[model samples]
Target: MKDINEPSTAPLVIADEPVNSEVIKTTTATAKNSSNKKSAGVSSQMQLLALAKNFVLDGGLVSSDKQMPLEERTQKRARIAALRKQENLEAIIKKSVNYCSATEFTNKADADWFSTFTELAEDVSNTTMQNLWAKILAGEISQPGSFSTKTLKVFRAMSITEAKLLAKACSLAVTEQTKRNIRIISGAYQTPGLLNFFSKNREQNITFSQFSLSYADLLILADNHLVFIQETESNPMNKSESFHFNFNGKPLTLTANKSSCVLKFYKFTPIGSELARLISDNIDDTYLQHLKSALSENFSIIEG
Candidate 1:
């Protein structure tokens, strides 16, 4: 017999049965999850309310015009448009900060350039375009005059499709090792000589269409001022002449096998070259092989 006041040496029971430990654990977990969700909802609502308050403080637009006059409604519409533009500018500024290099800016951007940039950038609503704008801003800040105002004017007029076309062109563009001029080499020709007076000059060219860039595409690029209006030929190279070029960021050397080896190519304009700096090197293996195969016939091709 135990004293009535003494504690009993027995497990606590619910309804005269053992409680399920697993069930209790699961119930507690569910309760915690519900609490967390409620807290998260409150936080989100608070943030949204803060934003709404700020917007209202900044002259919020009327949600509806049940009894508003036409003039008043038009004014409200313009205000909203301006506010949206301000928001876009703010977003671009934030994005530009992320791209700032650790190195101090070498020079300050021109005031006129910045003024023009803001005017055009405010109208850019697409995220991709916004990012591009941000990069331009960052680049200008790092090195003033890196991009010309003319380039900005041209780029501002470009559509997304045109931008993509430019990017594709950049991927195919090549530069000489010692020069920054970018060009798209499509063909090579041996100048007509006395031996071929009655026959056409020997030429080897690759169809750009097979590489996903058609002649029509080139025309579009030219119309946009991204490339020259016509295909240009380089001065003929003498026999055994060696040239160094950077193809898709790789070094390539070509030694001419015969005299008067002229290259047919499309040259990028100054504005185009400036914008091309923003593009990364993306090598097209098939196009590279095709170019090499064609050049091999007239010269010795070496790639590194």
Candidate 2:
């Protein structure tokens, strides 16, 4: 059916396809896709330009001599730098052994003892942990048999500062416990030097201040099961005096402050005595003689 020349209405052909709702939807989706591509391309170009600008401002994408020193800038090598893996860590630990024992170092014993606590090494990899570990180990080695499994457990339970305090206190029990024929004062064996050093005007007495422990320090030791402070029935009227004992061949004196406070005595537990053994064994003969004479002068046992 051909309309040759008379103004033929052959259904104005907009396109070859049907102009349905589906066609409209497809056209809209294609337009949206094209718009999204343009937006993405613009965003990508902006990011690239920003990166390039930043690079130019920051030493032109290269660290020149003025930007950084050669010491700070190590060149890359064909082989990568060693990574810090378990193997590397173990290697470092083993290598650290060489720096342990030297004559100049006071903690040589401690440095070597770290091997026993190798499991704790991870906690001490940094300087802070290393320092804490060194202090603890130093205390352990202060007395050969002082550090035990129990001590290790206790140390882990506390901070490094408290552990250091505990160790320092432990080292101060410098007298050995030995049976001696001495006078009993107030129903107890009293050392003469103990009384003499505590007498009035004690500053005139011989100086012995090497291992002076404060009330607080004693309390700390007591808490640790080393030594206990036994208050002898707090008597407000009773004033504890001071005395001196020969330590390190020096007449070291301890003067109890004259206070109407309750009298406290240091009673060494069995474990405390064990700790003392490693610190001092041989008592000075001269000091022993002095203690005996003082006790005799102070008390006389009356035969019933």
Candidate 3:
């Protein structure tokens, strides 16, 4: 976060290398051109990328062949590349903000988010350039709010698609609550060692496999700390023997079955809860209420 204003990198300039200076000078023209005309946007972006590369190569060069030893040159170049990449990322975020101005969702809030992300650009990965840009655009073109800088920083390092899938899966994992916590049915997954719930009342067991989520996707959420997990033998009372959820608007009945005593699963962490609140929508509220009511019918809190 060093200010770009602290005495330009003039000392790093080599007398013979005027190309870097020229490229740097043209950046203003490119940015201005992109700002003034939407038609030239593509060309402007290309130039910005080019200039970014040029800055790294030019900025890292030793003033004289003997000024720095050859052994350290590679390391110096690597550091310069990271700094240069960050600079380029700033440019990209800027362009995304400019493009947002024409969209219905664009507002001062979006601008603030953009600026926040821009400040944190240096820490984000640039490998998924297109995806990053798309996510940025999506944020701007929708509800804009101040996301947790720390949370988003971790998110920026992760795959956007995976984060989205995890979000969707969490939405589907809802179940009518009882004294025991709900275990989502392992739909489409014939994986062994799945400990689930079964009905003790009627002959039928509930399974809402229609709203299935991949086990792998849920694992990713756990890995990203967006969800929590624990592995143990089922010990809670009035839990389930089979892992099934009610698709119909009926209370899901569950009993503990001794078929698979071993268990490995995810539970929510504090951070995971925070993420769920951010990602989950009002669509799940009714379902949650149903679960709570069902649980309250049979479960009660014990006071010490």
For each candidate, what TM-score against the reference? 0.75, 0.30, 0.36
Candidate 3 lDDT (Cα, whole model)?
Answer: 0.45
Q: Relative to the true structure, how large is the alpha-carbon lDDT of every model?
A: 0.75, 0.38, 0.45
What would the TM-score be for candidate 1 when compared with the true structure?
0.75
lDDT of 2 at 228: 59
For model 1, residues 150-220, the per-residue Cα lDDT tens digits are 89999999877778788888878789875578998888878888874455437888688886788899889
Model 2: how far is 286 from its true place, Å? Answer: 20
Residue lDDT tens for model 3, 169-221? 55645333431243333211112332333333212212323334455666777
Instruction: Rank candidates by lDDT, best first.
Output: 1, 3, 2
Candidate 3 regions exceeding 4 Å error are 1-107, 110-116, 122-134, 137-142, 157-220, 228-304
Give per-residue lDDT, candidate 1, residue 190: 80
Which is superior by lDDT, 1 or 3?
1
Output the number of the TM-score-best candidate. 1
Give all candidate RMSDs, comma-separated: 17.9, 27.7, 14.3
Error of 1 at 296 (Å): 2.2
| Residue 254 in model 2: lDDT | 34
